[model samples]
Target chain A: MVMVPVVDYLRLEPEPHLCAHECTSCGARFFDRRNACAACGGQGFVDAAVATDAVVTAFTIVGFAAPGIEVPFVAAILDCGGTTVQANLRNVTPDADHVRLGMPVRLTTFSMGEDTAGNEGIAFAFEPAEQGGNA
Target chain B: MSDDIYILGISMTRFGKHPDFDAVDLGAQAALTALADGDVAMSDMDVIGAGNLLGGPGGFGQMLQKQIGQTGVPVYNVQNACATGATALRTVIMAIKAGEADMGLAVGVEKLSGAGLLLGGSKAADRDTWTPSGRVGAIAPTDGRIGTITMPGVFAQIGMQYLYEQSYAGVPLELFARISQKNHAHSTLNPLATYQKELSLEQIMGDFMVAYPNTRPMCSANCDGAAAAVVVSGDRLATMSAEQRRRAVRIRASVLTSDPYTEGCQVLFDVNTLTRRAAEAAYAQAGVGPRISISSSCTTASRPPSWCTTTT
Candidate 1:
């Protein structure tokens, strides 16, 4: 069986970390490919490593979802250094007390599922770092 | 030769589930009614613009023409997210401003009777098996995989962010419920609004939670609706009947905007910035801003409304 990062920016090798295309002109970092910078309209970009550790800027315990998708998950806005990252809070109880503003977390990954061709998609998330595993 | 544009007439279909009628049917009803309201026939329209999001792959303008009349004039189809209707209106306004057409028809229609979550055209994530699905997930969207690429989750984040930044007076959950309560109460006065009956504050707070800080009542109903307006140049209105001229509402200034660059907008989609920028520009162009009105309900108000604290 072979494993691959679900998203292009997620690098599974060495450690599960995020990479951003930083605008060379304005220093604005973003995931995925960008043709032009939104900040300065700059076309040039360089690869910048995202800090694995992040602080919870905002979060919500989602109670509803679409078909085939489960509910009661915590969606959060994480500050990876100065850049913003969106991910679900894993390995923690999905509630108000479990997740809060200014909570510290680190990047983590898990198996999503395997296809008929035996290609497993690995997805990344942030776990509470300051409180061991589940805070 | 005046470049000013005025709404000759406006009409809206009853906002509710039109299971029997499609989006085009709704659009046609509004368009025809608006034309009659202006006391003008379809032949008087010089151009047409239509906006429909989930109608189909076929553009709404041409299909709507089939229902109304085929004038063979310019047809512009707009698919802006929530501004589809506003964009269609503006499209007609620009045609009048450019001196291309004296009178135009603008229609915005959408059929969302059973629509689920607004995912911004992203494919739903498959939970059981790994497959190439939406941009956010191949296998699954949840399970701590990534941030929400959905609208409900985005609103939840916005509300929480507001509470965190500002020392608000009310509880975050209660405040969000109050916002929904205010909207539901206003619907009672609007005969065309869907679900005109008001829900008590307790019912709103006790409803099922769609997202944190947001209940099912807070979210907009996925009902089919369409609105159309007849727009004409100021000079054209003066030449029309005195009744048409008297009923016309002059549009002084309008501003439509998309997201501006903030590094955060790439992931979370910053709607707050867009509204803020649009409001500021609108005030400058119209030479007016919010002011206390001498309504019978409130004679002396010291503080801004609750909704004002959220944006500002």
Candidate 2:
């Protein structure tokens, strides 16, 4: 089997670190960082890892392909607790016809080709769990 | 004092791609032309209102104000998607009619086609929610989620629905093609229009279909253009002649309404009704109706399936 096609060059380090942001004022824990906070229009923001869980709010099966590449499949918009993250859906064969909305999915990592500016495009992918399994 | 505001002058930049110039340069060109056309010096104007659809550094209105050396006048920025020009006109008219300012200037400018993200409306990112089939196993490219439903699709759906329900005799696509051919012909007379050449119905209808029932020639070209209009109170026009008055089309009524989000194609729904409402209000304000000599709309004819294909 061509595991290289499936796995080679696609490096994924599953570091499930806590994702959080630090506000310079009041030192608040904001899950998402922004230029100005909804609470306070604070200018200072520091990115830090935070622990969180995401439920699949919605998903899609992407079947786009480039020249010489097998069509990479991905599911997107896995909602973590409340903050939504877009990720590739792995481990499940794609059925273009049948995929349920709001299906239970988890956060994972995936890879994409270099952009026109020649930058490696890395993204979080959504992994579908077997029935009754929650991540 | 219940009186109609009059358009003193109108101006527009050549509609095409201009990579080097930003929104301000395009805006000022039209503003200067309009001021010159109106026979008014920049120092005499009471207020400046600048309208821009997308992208720029801060102070778009100020950018134009500085360009013309009119730093003393209060400048307001108006941004309203495709209707940016019309909205700016409305603001100037209202201000003049209310006696807030005797002389007001309105300008709309946009550069739609050079290096930037494409627009697919408000629900673009929500495409994953709208069509899950498109998202699987794909790295969402920057332009991937751009709305493909052309202006034609919006109108075609309306036409299709009309055909399906009303049992209309005319083929909707043919009607759309006729509209495009007529507009393309109309643009030839307009030197500032991006498309200068005329197109045959066969040329318009036979071109590769962007959306069903709409062809290439049927749609407006992607353009970088700016439009400006100068307005003055009725008092300013007392000394002017019948010929000069004829040049200034009176704003009988101008009304603007927001979308309620009841339907999927809110733009088509809103525009058809808004045009009617504006017309009605204009007549009521001017004590006159459609018998007035001329009417004009600066609608975005950028793409398919829009009322632009149908309205003209």
Candidate 3:
């Protein structure tokens, strides 16, 4: 299967991990790079790997979407070891019974769409960790 | 600090779709209206600042100048997302404060409808390697859904958290609908608003859902419009007739700020914090207190509504 990452921040090879840049001076983690640390104006940064295990901090059932996109999906903010990342909640229905705040989740990947050549586009999401499945 | 700056005139086009008008057209229309309101000729303008997010062809400010008869005055384009209008005003204020120009024009225009929706279409080459996920780029996917969400989804997440965790005066989700109703009702009195019909709470709640707790009525419409203001230095105002002086409005202060970076925890950042800080700074500069009236366009569910009141 030909796989490509949707964004550079999501590392899919070998193992799924969220990559972040950490300011050397202020220890602030960011999904984007900075010429200077926003917290302390530090010029240096170090690569940081965010853990896959996280909990849903906030979420919404998006009922509207662009053309050809699905609706009523759970769009959620995950607190992965204090580094919050926004993603979609998977393996669960979009309802109050299936989703709740502070639910444990683990990072997972799935196919987005395929080109004419059949190369699958990959993106990241989180599913209930208790389900215990391969990422 | 030679003399205080005052707004001599202001004008805005009706806030609705103008299918016949482009960005430059709307900008020129507003600019002309402002100049006429100020009773000043285009030749009197020493500098021009134009604010816009999306436009076509030539530079927005320069194109506006072309339509309004350019007199060799300096023209600048300013873009700061939704803050484009305020940034343009700030730019002109700084120019006049620095004694660079005695009379300046600031105008903001947008053709959001003309720009088709393509939110997550940023090219990979344009993507910042350091922050690939920072913009509209895709992320890890789950189930059958792509992991990309737009601005409304982001705010909806925040609103969900606020609803789940915070308890202030027992405010319910209905408050959002009520707020939308109030806004629509107020728009009835404002001929410029895109949606002027008063919406009942039921109507707002029953509207098509965009995000959880946010329906169609609760969100702003993407319409085409422009607004403009003419500012002059105190020295320039002194030369104007008594009628102009009576019509002038002083700009006591203008401040701009941004959110500080925090560890990825979205809940740690309160959107109101930045606005509160900016408001405090403006109040101090204008020698006003918290009790003073405020006028703002902030639509965040977490912040209370505020209106502006001029203090003499």
What is each candidate's DockQ, to 2 decimals?
Answer: 0.51, 0.03, 0.37
lDDT of 3: 0.71
Backbone collision count in every prediction?
3, 28, 11
- Worst 10-residue lDDT window for candidate 3 chain B reads B303-312
lDDT (0-100) at residue B110 of candidate 3?
78
Give the best candidate by lDDT: 1
CAPRI-style grade of the A/B interface in model 3: acceptable
In candidate 3, what are the lDDT values of residues B17-135, reduced to their tens digit? 78888888888889999999999978988899888877544478898888887798988888876678888888999999888899999999877664533243233342222222444
Q: Which candidate, 1 or 3, has the higher DockQ?
A: 1
Candidate 2 vs. true structure, TM-score: 0.59
- For residues B1-312, write the lDDT of model 1, one tens digit per residue: 676789998999998889999888999999999999998878999999898877543688999898789878889999876777888888999999999999999999888877776562235434454554444334444433476656667777866766665745456668877777887898899898878979877998788877776777877777888899999999999898889999998877667787788768877666567777776776676676656211111010111123532221
Best by DockQ: 1
TM-score of chain A of each: 0.94, 0.51, 0.88
CA lDDT for candidate 2: 0.57
Interface RMSD of candidate number 1: 3.1
Candidate 2 deviant stretches above 4 angstroms: A1-135, B55-58, B115-117, B121-152, B239-249, B260-271, B291-293, B302-312
User: What TM-score does each of the candidates earn?
Assistant: 0.89, 0.59, 0.83
Q: For candidate 1 chain A, which ten residues in a row score worst on lDDT? A: A62-71
The CAPRI-style docking tier of model 1 reads medium
